[model samples]
Target: MTTDSTRRTPLVRLRSDGAVDEATLAYARTKIDAVLARPGLPAVTGEVRITRAAAHHAGHPWAATADVRVGRRQVVAVAEEATGTELVDRLQDRLRRQTDKAAHYWDDGRGTTAPPWRGGELRDGVSP
Candidate 1:
């Protein structure tokens, strides 16, 4: 097991809409590390942006967006949850799936088609 100092740091940004506690940030970093540990993701550097809804909500109000670079490909996922911990967990789940697909597409020659909104360029380039 590698210590925090040994792992590549993830760039995390807490949106100005709301503040995120230190504990939550630490937890998110750990989750990112776990996601990067999977096979075929030898070198990953990415960013995680977490935002909390400004208004009070009855349901999930926190959102997390992750952009991870695995090899020559990138994997992105977004998730929302009622609590900070839940938000992190959901983001981790999404990252795992996205990373798997990216790895398969780049390493295993599998035709893994990403979601329409996964890549930022793809999303920006599309016109309705």
Candidate 2:
């Protein structure tokens, strides 16, 4: 699989990718659910695609991509690892970073009527 970071929506449907196993898919779903449950986070939609490569790919045969949308922001992260758990962890980390940034940007107080100090204080220390 290609190692380059390609940032775009997946052409295939979310949860429709063929290669991911049931356990891994479940793990990804749980992770997505946790992110969505965050109180200050915006509305989101997301997908995960994990592909296992041939022997020619060497040490990193498992590649995973997570595409997520929070409000008007889109975050995409691609990673390759030797195991499914590691791949999921990396994807979750990347997605968290992206969403955190979006939350910070949108919560900057500029977009709302509240003063900047009030908005900054409201985030429960999630601001960037």
Across 1-128, the per-residue lDDT of candidate 1 in tens digits comes to: 11222234534332323666767767877887777766655467666777777678548778888776877788889998999999989989899898887776676445555665664235566733
lDDT of 2 by residue, 1-128 (tens): 22222223222223423345667756765665565557887766666667776565579877877777777778787888887778878877887788888888764345744444665544454543
Could you estimate the TM-score for every candidate?
0.67, 0.65
lDDT of 2 at 107: 47
Error of 2 at 34 (Å): 1.4
Q: Candidate 2 — what's its lDDT? A: 0.64
Tell me each candidate's RMSD, in Å, in order: 12.2, 9.5
Candidate 1 residue pairs in clash (backbone atoms < 3 Å): none
* Model 1, TM vs. native: 0.67
Candidate 2 lands at a TM-score of 0.65
